[model samples]
Target: MAATEQQHERALEIFLDERPELRIELDHLNPLLAQAKGETAAQYRAERLHEAFEAEAERLGLFAWELTLQLTAASPQDYQAQRLEVHKEVAEMAGMTWADYCQLHDL
Candidate 1:
């Protein structure tokens, strides 16, 4: 009955299949979105890298759980549990936790 069971299996597989890690280049990131006036290509590149990283991480984190909707409408608790599990998996897959990453980058 739960979406996390068999019915969600295939979609989960496909989504995982689609999200591959990318090598990032983030030299210029701030001015583009925040300061529209002085935003140069360098900033654009950084912004793009940031956006890409966000999207890739989201997908990899099993936010694609909508694929599991065919199985059931998961409760908030189920979704939260799954999200945490997915976040952990995603962070590990990408080589760090959110905390470790933020701290490492001094973010």
Candidate 2:
């Protein structure tokens, strides 16, 4: 798998933790990865995985920003600051300011 795919997969795994029902949805996702033999196919498969993840997230009333906020809120004060800093760095890498990222995601 590509690094990006691995990153997304790892994220999805984290999100699925403690949720067996969500883990089952991953079974539907695995075949797509296996079938992706070339760059174009892999990209297409990645998009499908993204769509699937979004659908499942919506069904569970989960949002990326909400999850991030929950994690930050649950962290120790020192860790919370570190997490926010990391989040801002990630947002910048994704081509958005931290404020814009929060706004865009309704954080």
Candidate 3:
């Protein structure tokens, strides 16, 4: 079934509850959001969310996109597969084996 706006909002609410510290960032960004209109608001919010995720990923010693995938995956298996795939791609790009890359990153 397709998710509803209310469901999305509830999911966001639950996510915020689990990560109260992010609320401060959200609060800080809300004024910017208020000033934006329509698509601009959506884009601005997406950028801010990406920035927030990037910051958190840095803190956690992970790539921002990787953290995003990890957090947003529909299931544990999905996350695992995506995580491995991303790592493998990154490792190939870096001219390293997956095992070596993981070891270097302490993953």
Q: Model 1 — TM-score against the truth? A: 0.32
Local error of candidate 2 at 28, Å?
A: 9.6
- Spell out the clash pairs found in candidate 3: none
lDDT of 1 by residue, 13-83 (tens): 44344543332234333454645655776656545654554475467553334335422335767655654
Residue 83 C-alpha lDDT in model 2 = 48
lDDT of 2 by residue, 6-44 (tens): 445566556567566645654455554555654455465
lDDT of 3 by residue, 1-107 (tens): 22335544554555566777776666566555546554455566656655665686799886655555556668889867877777777789889987899998777
Clashes of each: 1, 0, 0
Segments in model 2 whose C-alpha atoms lie over 4 Å from true places: 1-9, 14-39, 65-107
So what's the TM-score on candidate 3? 0.54
**Best-fitting candidate, scored by TM-score:** 3
Which 10-residue span in candidate 2 carries the lowest summed lDDT? 65-74
* CA lDDT scores, all candidates in order: 0.50, 0.56, 0.65
Q: Rank the candidates by lDDT, best first.
A: 3, 2, 1
